[model samples]
Target: MLTIWGRRTSSNVQALMWCVGELALEFQRHDVGHRFGGLNTDGFRKLNPNGTIPVIQDGERPPLWETGPILRYLASAYGEDDFWPRDPTRQAEVDKWAEWAKINVAMAFTVPVFWRVVRTPEAEHDHHAIEKALTALESTLAIADAQLSEHAFLCGSCLTLADIQLGHVLYRYYDIDISRTSLPNLRRYYDTLTERPAYQTHVMISYDELRRN
Candidate 1:
């Protein structure tokens, strides 16, 4: 069985867990990082030098770190040709969406929201930073909403790795309170994502608990 090292609440870790459920692969998970705090130990660093959560070790292959790469590896390895598109052009489209999620979406939206709402102390919170982050996220989400209106998934009709990666971030957005943003298409897409059994089990959690930690 594969071994996943990270706390359950980490968005990156949640993405891997969701992928595992989607593929129906059996694995063991260990709580590490954040409040758990085993990441800096020499044994843990041997697997992930960066001391980040969501690291994974397969039976033979070297351990993997970072969220997006881990998702691609699992989808390609265990998902066969199902979750990933076979055609080169379509595969490129999938890659494009995944890349967008990492660079534009995760950096601008997920990280800031996580820091402000979960990590930072309420008294020390920077409202201006949160506001700026939210504005940037809303802009990006509007673009996604428009795209979702045209296509069933990020790349096209089929659910691919793109959806898994972006969907995890969408989970975070749903928790945060946003003002006056009209994103019907995005909302519909998010609802569809939540309907999946894997999402309900692994991604959806009470915002109060997330904030409390």
Candidate 2:
């Protein structure tokens, strides 16, 4: 059994959960982060020095921190061929987009936009910073839109680690009250992801708890 530490609403945790769900791996999830304050405890600190959410303890192996590596680890260890390829070349292809998604899309929105718009109170919102972040994110998403235009998934026809890395962020991107450029391909991909039970269970969740009144 695996032990994962993080709040369900945390995007980083959600990514790992989505991957775990896709693999149908049974595991225990400990609530932490935000109002759940176990992250500051000595035990949790031993697991992750940075005190980030979504740390995974796999039996005797050392606990794993960081969403990207955790996803790759779970996929490689437990994912079927469709989710994670054994071939190095094929895996590299999936790795590229996973890196892009984490750095470009996830990082762009969570701190600059989501935290500002959703976490911050309405009176204290930084509209200017949000708009700037949105503008920058738009350009990054456009590249994905073009790539999705050519195939059903990021790397190819079937869902892979690449899609898992990027797909979790789509829910907030669409649901948030923000202006977005027309992205038919990205929209189509998101629709396809919605049809997946794992994605719905792990990724398509409300962040109402995270919002300020």
Candidate 3:
């Protein structure tokens, strides 16, 4: 059994939860960020000095924080060779795509794009800035679109840790109101992800609570 501490709506938490779900691991979660507002609490701060969400602890092991390490820990411990290859070379291959997705896609989309459109008031939106951000974002998505064109998943034909990192954001990417450039392969890949029970349960959650209405 695993213990998780993060709100379901958190993208980082969604990624971890999806991993847990995929591995059929038993776990429990608590809401503790954004509107939940428990970050600065002494207990949470002790669990994670950074006071970040998506922290986890497995049985007697020390608690883990930071989304990347926590996900990697789960993959290392629970993931099979297909999901997170045990071979160093194969592992690097998956890690490459995972890092690329986090740095290129997640970083570009979250603060610059999603927050701009979803968290900011409509009246205060900067359309020009938004367009510029979208332009930059699509350039990265095109890379994934191309990779996905050749293979069914980010790392290969089967889902891997890379997919967890990359695909977690697609739900909001598609649901939000924006003028998106069509990349058929990317759309197909995302559509395939939508069919998964774990993805549907964790990654496809509604973020209405985070909206600035």
Question: Pick by TM-score: which candidate is best?
Answer: 3
Write the residue-wise lDDT of candidate 3 on 1-213 in tens digits. 898999998889999999999988999788899888999999999999999998898998999998989989999999999999999999999999999999999999999999999999999899999999999999999999999989999988999999999999999999999999999999999999999999999999889988986
lDDT of 2 by residue, 6-79 (tens): 99999988888988888899899999999889888999999999989889988889999988889889988998
lDDT of 1 by residue, 73-191 (tens): 88878885647867788777888888887778877776686678666777877788888888888898788888999988887777788888788888778766555377998888989
Where model 2 places Cα greater than 4 Å from the true spot, the runs are none
Instruction: Supply the global lDDT for candidate 2.
Output: 0.91
Q: Estimate the lDDT of model 3.
A: 0.93
TM-score of each: 0.92, 0.97, 0.98
Runs in model 3 deviating more than 4 A are none
Clashing pairs in 2: none
Candidate number that wins on TM-score, 2 or 3:
3
